[model samples]
Target chain A: MNILVLVKQVPDSEALVQVKGEGSGVEVEDRYTLNFFDSLAVEEALQIKEQTGAGTVTVLSLGGQKAIEALRTAIAMGAAEAVLLEDPAFENGDEYATAKALAAAAKGMEWDMILCGKEAFDDSSGIVGPLLAEFLGIPLVTTVVKLDFISEEQAVVVEREIEGGKEVIKAPLPVLLSAQKGLNEPRVASVMGVMKAMQTEIKKLDLAAVGLSQSEVGKAGSKEEILRYHRPPERPPVTMIQGEATEVVRQVVALLKDEAKIL
Target chain B: MAGDVWVFAEYQAGKIRKTSLEVLSKGRELAEQLGSGLGVLLLGSGVDGLAQELTAYADTVYYGDNPLLEKYNNDVYYQIIAALAEKEKPHILLAGATFLARDLFPRLAGRLKTGIAVDCLSLEMGDDGSLIARRPLFGGKVLADVVCREGRPQIALVRPNTFSLPDVQSPAQGKVLPLDVTVDTSQVKLEVLDVTRMAKERLDLTEAEIIVTGGRGMKGAENFQLLDDLADVLGATVGATRGVVDNGWRTHDDQVGKSGKTVSPKLYFAVGLSGAIHHVMGMNTSKVVVAINKDPQAPIFQYADYGVLGDLFEIVPLLTETLKKEI
Candidate 1:
């Protein structure tokens, strides 16, 4: 089994994001890390390779310089190779265009399975994975929580979440799966692994290297144009209801009825 | 670009989901604005009954009936929806951002080579007849307005409670129209083996009008019963903070935070949890926030509209009792 995982660098969940006054974009905190679900994806791929003991695990990410850190982190975890798809032309692409470039990259390599984070922390679109599957003409089963080998080279059965329930499904090889939360507990890299990752050269590929064009990726290739970003309406100060428990409860309820009028 | 507005009316566990109706209500408003017809797409086996319910809102109900579509098979549903979009060429396609829609609509848009916005907070008609969808990013801290400059049927998946349920039309106008869909069994790849419903089915947080959430101060897993009792009185759902869920006091499914689900309930009751930024990110979209913590300085008070300082045990039951009488 040849396993390839797609990872992304995103603002840390705890990172404070402030919308700029010009409405161009928000100024995000400098903190960045591998997306939570993508870490699970990388972990699941490494575990699959470890269990099969045959196929190689390669981690791939599409971003600027910071994306390499995500790849290095994945490599430190256990991936054998890393590829960074970075180029000015590939920047600001929507899910459709991003999938187009990633599919081109996948065509340049040989892999039996592809795994991606269910959604990124920054965008949370959850569209790129399925779009990549469609672009590759492969079947996709998303939000997968469990996987079992039916045949090492042929097929696998997976369990995915649904509304108030879960569904167990089977899919053939050369398929794409999006890792949901609870898939597995990710492991931290050892000091040796981190040192080895830093020494290893990260392969960088531009749009041309992936056989993509300027009009086929990034903002040019994007279908939806983001006009601007703005902060949500500011909330009011809290009305503290002090005194006895009963009195405080009464005040809160009365405020909910009179002021908020939501009850 | 004169075309009709299409809505994917999702039927789950035998009834049309309320979120579908919510989207349809908004779709109706959009259709009226564009001076176009409104239609609903129903895909399932023996769903004519559900289609009838949809007619109260939509003008035409287009349903595709097949055993293969009995349970949502991704490939089959995608093929049929794409084929319909190809044939009908509707101006806009709307769906409720349920788990299934979130899983399928983006894939359909890719196949159709169109633009789509998910988890949209609001949808507006641009001057150029394009779809302007404003959606939250980086959780609910910021909002971005997006538009599809060039796309046949602009697609959007709206969050569940963003729009109110429409009043049922006195005389239902929708007429059921069976779509032409041929399922090539050979083309279908994935096969579902089994589906298990949850033992205790609570109101989905995204759709709940009110949520009463407990935190570390709830004490333990058993103490969640207080939240449930409050929720019962308020006709709300129960949710938990990350601390409570991480401590195994509640399942991750019941969790609301940066790591869990984002909710926009009309009224939110915060019990004993510090107003951590991660937790606030998920529920700050709420209309009215009520925080009950012993510590007045807890961070949640900053975001909450009303804060009741007291022990949760004494306060929760008393509040429930007080509301039971006042309401």
Candidate 2:
């Protein structure tokens, strides 16, 4: 089995985001890290490879030099190889363009399964995996919390999260699954793994190599344009109650009854 | 190509979802402003009866009743919706940013080569007659106004609980148009084996009128019983912070945070939660918030309407008991 994992580099979730003045755009911070959900995707791939014992895990990312760090991080976590889709033409692309480019590059690879994070933290557009599956002409199951290869080479059963519960789905081989949180705990990179990752040569591909022209993969291909960004208005100031636990509880009950009137 | 504003009326188990009604209400406003008709695309098995309910807000109801669409098959729904958009040429398309819509709309946008703004908090018409969608990004740290600059159908997924339903004035004399489309079964490669509701069967946090959430300070899974007691008394739902969910104390569906489900209930209780921004992002839109924690410095207090600095194990029970008596 050959498993391919799609990875993305994003700002650490804890990092503060600063919007540029007049909504020109968001300022790019230097504190870049592997997107939290994607790390879970890498771990799932590694575990699948370990269980199969005959497959290689390949990590693929689309970005600039910063994204290589994400790929290396995945490599250090036990992925066998890394591929970076890098090119100037890929800049300022929307989720559709991004998925198109990813599908283009993936069409050349031979793999049984493709995995990605349920959504990227930056855009919060959980579009790519499904869109990629559509572009690749494969089946996709998003928000997968549990995955098991029922037939090894032919089919996989997955538990996907839904509104109030979960759905048990089965898809044939050559399917795409987007990893949601709680799928599995990601393993920490070992010292040996890190050393091995440093020596591994990361492969880079551009628009031409991915079989797409400049106009089909970047801003020209994007259908949406960002007009501006602004900080959401702040909520009203909180009214604090200070006292012993019982006293505070009594005060809260009184306030709810008299002030808010929800009681 | 500018035409009617269309809303995808999502339904499950033969009833239309509340979020779809909310979108219809909002779409009616936009359609009136644009001097265009408000239409609803209702698709399901034997859904003609339910399609009539949409007449309160829509001017045209497009009903596509098919057994193949009884359950949502992403490919089939995408194909039908995309085909409708191609022929009808809607100016604006809206759906609730639901699990179903989130899974379907993006694929449709890709197939149609259009832009989509997901989880939008608000929508309006831009000066150039384009749809302006304001969406929260960076985990609610900033709101970005987005537009489908040159796309014919501006697609948007409206966040649930963000808009109120308009009052029913009179039964609208709307036209019911049957959607003629085909489903290619060979295109669908995935099969649904089964769907099981979570064991707890509690109210979903997103739609709950009141939510009481615990954090790591709750200690363990067993300690959540205190929150359950409070929620039962208040007729509320129970939720957890990401830390508690990460600790395996609760299901991910119970998590209230950026990565979890965003909820805006009428009232919220942050019990024993330290108030991380990730958790706050999900509940900050709540109408009234009350925080209870041992530490006075818990960040959640900043977003709460009322705060009680105390031990939740003590305060929660006391509050529940007092509320029980008061009610």
* Segments of candidate 2 deviating more than 4 angstroms: A244-247, A250-263, B199-202, B325-327
DockQ result, candidate 1: 0.77
Candidate 1's displacement at residue A56, Å, is 1.0
Best by DockQ: 1
User: Where is model 1 more than 4 Å wrong at Cα?
Assistant: B199-201
Q: Weakest 10 consecutive residues, lDDT, candidate 1 chain B?
A: B197-206
Model 1 pairs in collision: B275-B300
Alpha carbon deviation, residue B8, candidate 2 (Å): 1.4
- Per prediction, the TM-score for chain B is 0.96, 0.93
Candidate of highest TM-score: 1
Candidate 2's docking class is medium
* Cα lDDT of model 1 by residue, A122-166, tens digit: 888899999999889888988888988666448989988776678
Q: Give per-residue CA lDDT, model 1, range B264-326, as digits (tens).
A: 899999999998987997898888898989997899999988888889999998988898898
